[model samples]
Target: MIQILVIAILSLIAQLVLPWWSLAIVTFVVCFWRSSSALTAFVYSFLGIAIVWLGYSLWVYGQTDGVFIMRISQLVFKANNAVLPFVGTTILGGLAGGLAGLSGYFVRQVTGNQSMSHTA
Candidate 1:
């Protein structure tokens, strides 16, 4: 829960000022600092970023009256539906966080610093 909260908040702030890739950095650092296992790191990171992205996309859709995401959806996915783009955005963001989180977890393991060793 803490990992999810930290990653989601940091990722939201990061996205506002930084490039999209900053989500990976936020998730990686959060998991490295708090994750208890590989699965926990990946799942929590995935959920955090996915939730943030989904919410942000919804906000943008509302603000732009769905024009922005709809166009993106058609251009990138050859679809006319907003749902595709929403799901795609969430999944992609989650994937970036999940992979970076796994990397962080493994690096922490290699360094033998299981600071939060309790199971999630």
Candidate 2:
């Protein structure tokens, strides 16, 4: 239906526009269409995407920067380290990506039943 399409677009927008809590709105909308169970599906989707993002970041950092995570870990114990800001930024980026994934998951879950069905 048109409503589901609109919701899917909005969810994609939430991922594109916001970083953290992107799914906050989309989750509510999906719940309206499905139920709270859809929220769990969204979380799983977010986690799956977040893991991929994290792995990609780690790989890139390893290739270009070398031992970035080790340096970050050391910075965590050392309060005056300069890498703190970099680590903080990385966390924020991850949050954004996670939110986007959450939005995607909810959109799929909400629309799955309607769109995936065979209508004669």
Candidate 1 lDDT score at position 98: 93
Residue-pair clashes, model 2: 1
Best by the lDDT measure: 1
Instruction: Give the per-residue lDDT digits (tens) of candidate 1, residues 3-119.
Output: 798899999999899999999888888878888889999999999999999999999999999999999999999989889999999999899999999888988899988865555
For model 2, how does the per-residue alpha-carbon lDDT over 1-120 read when each residue is reduced to its tens digit?
A: 333344345555676678635544654444334333444434433443344344445665668665665566566755545355455554554455445445545565656654542221
For candidate 2, the TM-score is 0.35
Each model's lDDT: 0.90, 0.48
Scored against the true structure, residue 41 in model 2 reaches a CA lDDT of 38
Instruction: For candidate 2, give the lDDT.
Output: 0.48
Q: Look at candidate 2 and give me any clashing residue pairs.
A: 19-96
TM-score of every candidate: 0.93, 0.35
